[model samples]
Target: MNGTLTLDGFCHRLAADPLRYRKLHPVAMAGEFVDHFGVPPFPRMEGIAGLLDRSGIGTVVLSHETGGLRGYHVGTRDGGYLIHVDASEGRVGQEHTALHEAYEVMRERLHDLHPRIGLAAGISLCRQADRFAAATLMQPYWFAIFAEASGLDVVALQASYGRSYASLTIRLAEVMRHQPLLAVLYERGPQAERPPGMPGQVSEGLRATVVARTPGFRLRMQRRPLSALRGLLPRRGAPPPPGSVAERVALTGRPAAVDRVSGYDLWRADDLAVLARPVIWGGQVAKVSVVAVPYRDRSVLLPQFANAAFERTFHAHQVL
Candidate 1:
């Protein structure tokens, strides 16, 4: 992403360097930017701004939004672009918007050249731009570096990385962490009372709202319709069993690792084992993060989970 690079000429570069670049996907393109520019690990606003500048795009942070739009970009007569992000979205949201608008503005250039395009192409382009934004903002190579210290603590990662829960978690899933780990982040669906000692807690009955995992790891008997992710918790599922470790963690932010000699399974799956960790914000359990691994036998030893990068090993099992 050199300052000379222009949005209008992006397609031309793809055509000119077909052999060098095999795919036109935005995620791949964003990766190219990350690699090409040597974007620093754990980038922040200044870093992202540098990226935008390198891409020949001017930026403006507006205190107010326009027509409910969080961000938008416009082409300049000088054959470059200028992106504007509304400050109302907060720091994290603004960073995301800035990166997202950088990709989204490319669509305007494409549409200008081709007055009309197929419906599918337009939809595909938008999706690609979204992916590009995410991939660029969160460099995958940094995962290993971050994990070395904090492990795969999603709450800490989300906060430290300055990303939304859904964005960071989904990016983790997409990048495919090295270990065979699947971490699901979820919130309580309904409640009775905050378990004793867990003050300010509001709810019970945990339900998965976001999912992140290494490739191919899944719950047994999932239908995987539409998308493999939808089948994870919403389909053919129930809340973690009452008195189960998951229920305990959800009700109370205490971590749990238990061996099911003949105990509870979130859903009746023979292979689904779990370890529940509470994600706390402001001293209340905002949500729970589940680290699942495949293991069985009387010992209930979690040898398979050694590489999952938890700060401490999980002795038991979990559900999101």
Candidate 2:
């Protein structure tokens, strides 16, 4: 499939055998695509541009004006593609939009099959391109290594990878599909309601908490008081401790290191400690944190939880 796994090809495959493609991880597929194109690992912005140029995109234009539309891609008279990005959206947003447009341009088969492909197919293709761009920007292997090394801190991972919080949050969910011990929470405001599209309901006067966890881990959390801590879901009763790391980070927009606490401080577990960091969005503080059973092994200093797949993959790739 070298040099041939175009966006349209992936969409066709997904349409023909939805379950098969659904089971495959987006990051892994994107890594394979990069490897096939011979792009360097952990490609930077310039590298991504180069890849786009090679994939048939001719020019990338950035507009500083703020508008309703983030960006768009269009075919020029010369049969080349031009991508226009909204620079006003900032660096991370511009990068994401550019990559998404580039992927759209690379869907050579889509143009050929446009007349035959209906609206549903077109939507699927668009969704596939979005995922492809995200995975390309945040390569799975690099992200996995960074997650482990950075103690699963979303802010640190965002700095290291130069990804937007939204992108990093989505990628975290993708990574959690393989790492059961991993979970990420986004607390929007002091008493923010549950984020739109997130499952479960929050208790009155509580802040929003969107939890993303692996299936088994989520099931285990569900069996306990932490059931409300399920993926992107809110807790059913009571707010977290006011002095808890999550609350402190939300209020102060600062990082906090805390010892294990009782009664909904985090996961309702006595053994788990937390490192909470504020996720700043639109100049406002959004509390985000990483939780894990504290590490007992001398080999690692930070919390080390059991994740066989993550351990095997990390060791095999020498990412740790």
Candidate 3:
């Protein structure tokens, strides 16, 4: 079997013997998933796109008006997958989806190899594979390092890992020298102690004061107050629906989708303000925080940063 036949055969084989094929695959942290697949980690998914391109698959960003739907991966008979993702989610999120699609393809191939193997029948095996892939790609180890380095505690850990939000805060805290922030937040006890909205909505006055007191944190206020959040407008359109991404982040004290602004440091500028710098001892994001920026200001800042902060922060803290 070669070319089209080989591809078809591979898919069929996986479908036939899903268990046997899945068994051979290695599992690690989410970061390892990217590494093993010859792609970059979550926050840097261009590597994944590059890999897809090399395989003759085109990853395009087409508007919904152009018959493009979000969150669907369409595989061409020629052995390529065309993945449509929301522009807002960007490459990191999209790459995770792509990896998921690839895993399905691999599964099909495994089943084809052993027609009698039913991964569906072996629920444990299927679940284990998924956990392995998610854990590997999420790179919890790196996340742990960045968290500790930043001085984050269990409560802060929820912000970094509990939600679907990107995990860059830990790493950014490490790089920015904000371990004390994490220390302070953790020392404050469980986040449950604070009013639900309080932790995520640090005031600007508080931000200024905390940074002022923590000289070692290395945060320099940009000469210009950050470009206001209004800059993210869709050009003369209604603002995002009520309960938008920023709103969610603010309420949860967790990094949310809004953190993926194109230029801002996702970890430092989102709903959770930067009171301190994150540390990256070893290869992960450690504990870090600041006095907390007001929810409104942090909301504004989120539009300018990329998701890199999540991975950077998480990786930095995890090492610590």
- Best prediction by lDDT: 1
- Cα deviation in Å at residue 225, candidate 1? 12
| Model 1 misplaced regions, further than 4 Å | 1-4, 15-22, 75-80, 110-130, 188-206, 218-246, 259-273, 296-320
Per-residue lDDT of 1-320 in model 2, one digit per residue for the tens?
A: 43444454444544455363433344554655676566665666566666666655547777765366788877889777777878677666777777777666644544355534332247676676678778887776777887777656676677787776656766776764555443446555454465554333332233435445554343233455643544322332333343345555555566555443333324543233445565666887644554433222112215323221111111111000
Better of 1 and 3 by lDDT: 1
Query: Residues 166-193, candidate 3, lDDT per residue (tens digit)?
Result: 2233333333343323222211112233
Model 1 lDDT per residue over 1-320, tens place? 44326544554454456453344466777776566556676567777877667656555555475568877777678777777777677776777777777766654554565545212255675667667777877777776555434445555566667776656666766665555555666675555455455334323545566656676564443443455433133322234434445556767567765443121244434444556667677787776665554444212224323424323333333333
Task: Give each model a TM-score.
Answer: 0.67, 0.63, 0.36
lDDT of every model, 2 decimals? 0.57, 0.53, 0.37
lDDT of 1 at 254: 73
Q: How accurate locally is residue 187 in candidate 1, as Cα lDDT from 0 to 100?
A: 71
Query: Which ranges of candidate 3 are over 4 A from the true structure?
Result: 1-35, 41-43, 55-70, 121-133, 151-320
**Deviation in Å, model 1, residue 157 alpha carbon:** 1.5
Q: Which stretches of candidate 2 lie over 4 Å from their true place?
A: 1-29, 64-68, 88-90, 106-108, 111-130, 176-178, 185-210, 219-244, 252-254, 257-271, 279-286, 290-320
